[model samples]
Target: MIGSVANMLAHVKNCSKARKVLIYIPYSKFKFNLLLAFERYGFVKRVSLLRYSTNRSEILIELAYNGYYNMIQDIVQVSKPGQRIYWKKKQLRVKHQIGTYFLSTSNGIKTNLDSTCVGGEVICNLV
Candidate 1:
């Protein structure tokens, strides 16, 4: 599970870079929440669940693109399995106009722009 989160981000980035319309990833609640956060911030066009072949589940992510470029420029994981990073609401800041910091707060996974975000683990920075 150490690389699960990183794998999820990689899948999205690689698929987008390859100009794919959709990508599938093994499903987990944490990954689903992260994808939802990405969709809320317009990084992904849509996200849905798929169940088939002996109840196995997968996530269907629709990559959002603008002409030749993808909506997600890059995803940098801040909190790793061995080293988790946490920040307060006041400490959270986004330095770039197109950048968004995703956090795992008490309420749920949320982007830095969420007015009600309380802050928890610094999941990743999305650009």
Candidate 2:
């Protein structure tokens, strides 16, 4: 069972390389919420929830691009199964690079720019 966040994100990167319009991914609350934040940041287009089982669902993610070039140049997982990394509001004050920081905050998954309250685990950096 490939359920790790890193594993799931790898699939997304692969889809971007393939230049697919849309891709379906196994849904987790964290991943779903993160994708919503991505949508807000213009990294993705549309998102639709697809119910498969009582306890399981899937998300159809419409990718975004710039004139055939994949918008997401890179996606890197920071905190992982072995070593976990956490960040704070002050730590995130630094301006992110071409992409943004997706963090688990008190409110929910949010980009560093949008995060106000104390930040939690640093999930992934999206470029």
Candidate 3:
């Protein structure tokens, strides 16, 4: 039942708030790409794929922090099943340079660092 991106984002946000060393999440390609984006921008320490319950797979994400502060100040789910948000290439705007967005682009999942410009659902914003 916990297969939605919103659920995953909420889990990550909660883990960040608790300052968990490691968090286990269900396998999802989009999730994997999203984690990679976070890692690319130094928001996360590590991401590993491991077998879970012998048959299924899971992702282990290592939260990043400096001193006593967590790297992520807040993470908000932008596109949901109930409501979807999309921005065209012309409308693309990055509110925060340090903030990163998980976008479901036509080509694939992309981060703000990439400048190709794609129009798709904005999954979540992480900072």
Candidate 4:
């Protein structure tokens, strides 16, 4: 299953025409696999783990693109749901951008939007 998914991503990477790439992985294990796959294909310029939270077992990846943003976006959109929890005790309806990275935890969605960044960040620090 992983191999097939990787192969599909490889296809997307091949057809990409953007200058930078942004790969978002809500789970760390899957993120590692993605990094490895990109590295193996020599398609990624740079990779970074942007956000981390103990409450949620997930990771957000930011990949620098050379000319494949649109392609990457297409692939990301079709990826499976990365939410770690099926339900939350304290449900919070937080606004999130199309490509913004986040992880859903057991506690629920926690964010501070009254500061620097809108939707600041969702920290699911419950489980």
Top candidate when judged by TM-score against the true structure = 1
Off by over 4 Å in 4: 1-20, 57-127
Per-model TM against the reference? 0.90, 0.89, 0.86, 0.31
* RMSD to true structure for each model, in Å: 1.9, 2.1, 2.5, 15.4
Which window of 10 residues has the lowest lDDT sum in candidate 1?
Answer: 90-99
Better of 2 and 3 by TM-score: 2
Candidate 1: Cα lDDT at 92: 64
Better of 1 and 2 by TM-score: 1
lDDT, candidate 4, 17-92, per-residue tens? 4433454444554445545444443444444554456655433334445453332434442224363233232233
Kindly indicate the candidate among 1 and 4 with the higher TM-score. Answer: 1
Worst 10 residues of 3 by lDDT: 90-99
Q: Give the TM-score of candidate 2.
A: 0.89
Q: Is candidate 1 or candidate 4 better by lDDT?
A: 1
**What digit string (tens of lDDT, one per residue) describes model 3 on residues 1-127?**
2136677788889989988989999887778888887888888899988886777999999999999999988998777776788877655664644567777887877765578856677777787
RMSD over all Cα atoms, model 1: 1.9
**Number of backbone-clashing residue pairs for each candidate, in the order shown:** 0, 0, 0, 14
**Candidate 2, residues 14-124: lDDT per residue as tens digits?**
989889898998887778888888888988888778998899889999999989788887889888877888987788787545568888877888777773647888889
